[model samples]
Target: MSNSLQYIFGGPKAWDSGLWTASDDRVRGGSSISHLYTHPTQAKFYGHLDTKTLGGAGFASQRTVGDLALDLSCTEGIKLSLGWDSSDQTFTLNVKDTIPGKREDGRDEAGVSWEYDFKAPENGGEIFMKWDEFKATYRGREVEDPEPLKLNDIKRISLMARSFFDKQDGDFKLYVNWIAAVKKDDNDSDDDGDLKKHALEQRSDPRPVWKRLFCGLL
Candidate 1:
C-alpha cells in the first residue's frame, strides 16, 4: 500500500471529540487553565499561565483522550498547519508511546516522552518534523540515556504552553489548522531533494530550547 498523509486531529471529527485540559495549577496551587476550541477548519488552543504561585513555573496543556492510539510508523513524522493567528511564543509538541499502568496509590506511572519545540510564524506556515527531530524527555527533563520512540504505539499527543522557568508567562493562544502524519513520497529523487532543503532550513533557523539541559542540542 502506498503511504499517504493521514489526519490525526482537526476538522469535523475533532470538533466533537473530547480533549482533556491539564494545567500545573492542579499541582502547585495556581489557577492556570487551558482550552481546546475546535472548528470545522481548525483548532484553537488558548490559556493563561500563572507563574506567581510556583515562583515562575507554570504550564497549561491539552491532550487527546486516553482511548486514542495512533500507529504512525509508515510516516516520517508530523506536520502541523499553522493559522495566521498563531503566535511566535514557543510551544512544545509531545508524544507518548507507552502509557504506564496506575500505581497502587492511584497515580499514573512515569514513562518516556518524545518532545519537539517550535515557534510558529506570524503569517503561518507548515512545520514539518522528522522522527529524529524529537528529543526524549522524562518528567520534564531530558533523558541522557534515552530509549527509542515506539512509532507503532503512539498513545498520546499534547500541545503545551509553559513558563520555561520564568522565561515567559501570561495569556497565550495558538491557532492550528490541522495535524497530520507526513508520509514519504514515492518519487525518491524529488523527495530526497526537498527533504534535504527542508532539513537545512530548519537547522539554519533553530527554535529556542525549552528544556535547560538540552540547550546544547539546539
Candidate 2:
C-alpha cells in the first residue's frame, strides 16, 4: 500500500473561511495587492508585486487563519500540487509554530518562523519539501540559531510572492490543486502510478466551485 497524504488545505474542502491575504502594503506604504480565488479543483493566487516603493523589497501573500494545530510531526513535510506562470520569480512557503498574545498596544508579538523557497514549474507539477529543508527566520531575516520547528503545534501555513531583494516584481499567478502533509513513499518506483491514480481521483470528484473568490478568517 502507498503511504497516504492527508490534505491540510485545498483538496476537496477547497478554500473557505480559513484563508486570508496580507500584503507589504500594510507596512511599506505601497499599493501592491494579493488575492486568492478558489475553484472546485484548485485555488489561484494572483496579484501585482510592487517593489519600487520599497526599494526592491515588497511582498504579498495568503495565509491560513486561526490555529491550525496541525500535528505533522509524524510526516516528512509538505507536498504541493501547483502551476504557475512566472518562471523567474520565486515563492516562499512559511510555517509558524507559535502565535504570541497581543502586546500592550494590541500589536502582534513576533515569533519564529520556518520558511522554504521554491521556483514554480512551467506547466505545473508536484513540489515536495522535506522537514529539514526549512530554514528558520526571525523578523524577515534568516537567523543563525533558532529553536527547532515545532511540528506538533504548527499554527499557520502561508504562500508568499516576494521581491527577493529586487530580483523580481510585477503581476504573478499561481494555481494550486492542493497542499498536504506527505511522507516519502517507500516504494519510489510506483511514483508515476500513484500520480496517475491521484489525477483520476481528482477528475472523478464532483464538488462544485463556489462562486465567491475570497474567504476571510472565521
Candidate 3:
C-alpha cells in the first residue's frame, strides 16, 4: 500500500452475490435496482427511479465487501472508470456507519464511519472525486471540514444512481472498474524510528567523541 492511499474494491472479478442485496420497492414511486452478469470481465448495475414516490425522490444502491480495513488518508480523492448504457442519469456515492444486523453467516454488519459522494453526468465519462469536493455528513447533517482520511479506518463504500427528475422513464446502465483512492503527498512521517533518530543526531545534535575526533582529523 502507498503511504498516501490504498485500493479497497472494484477489481476485475465480479461481485460476490451473497454479499450484495438490492432494493426494488418503489417507495413513493421509486425504481428497482439490480445487478446482472454482463461478461467475464464486468458487472452491470441498472435500475429505475420512481418520480411519483416521495414527490420525485429516488435512490438505488449497491454494496460490496464490508469486512476489510480501508485506508483513505493519503488520497486527495477517489478515481474510477464509468460508462453508461444511456445519456440521462447521474450517480451518487455514499458511505454509511456500520450496519447492526446479522447476515446468514452470523456476522454483524461492519462499521462505516465515513462517506464521500460524486455525481457522474450523462456524458459516458469517468470521474475523479476530489477530497475538497467530498461532503462529509454524519447523522444526516454535514460535518464542517473533517480531517484527511487515515486510510487505516475506513469501513465501507457504496454507489447510487438516480433520476434527477421524477416521472423520467428510461433504461440506465452504469459500469464501474478501477475504483480507488488517489494519493496526495503531504508531510507524512516515516515510521522508521532508528532512521529518523540517526538523521536528527547527524544533523543537529552533537556527535560522540570518536566521531568528533574523526571529523577533526578530516
Write the number of the candidate with greater TM-score, choosing between 1 and 3.
1
TM-scores of the models, in the order given: 0.77, 0.77, 0.60
lDDT of 2: 0.72
The residue-by-residue lDDT of candidate 3 on 1-218, one tens digit each, is: 44233343455444455555564434224555555434444456676655455565555666655443443444567776665553346556665434446767754433333555454455546577775666665432467676554443455566655544463434556776546566564344345685466455445634343222211111
Residue-wise lDDT of candidate 1 within 1-218, one digit each (tens)? 45455677763335433555453454446667888887878888888887888787777888766744555655689988898877667998989988767878765567687998999888988898889999998766899968789775688888988877778888888999888887655542245566576546446643422211111112
By lDDT: ranked, best first: 2, 1, 3
Error of model 3, residue 55, in angstroms: 2.8
Clashes of each: 0, 0, 13
Candidate 1, residue 130: how far the Cα is off, in Å:
1.1
Runs off by more than 4 Å, candidate 2: 84-88, 100-107, 184-218
Clashes of 3: 13
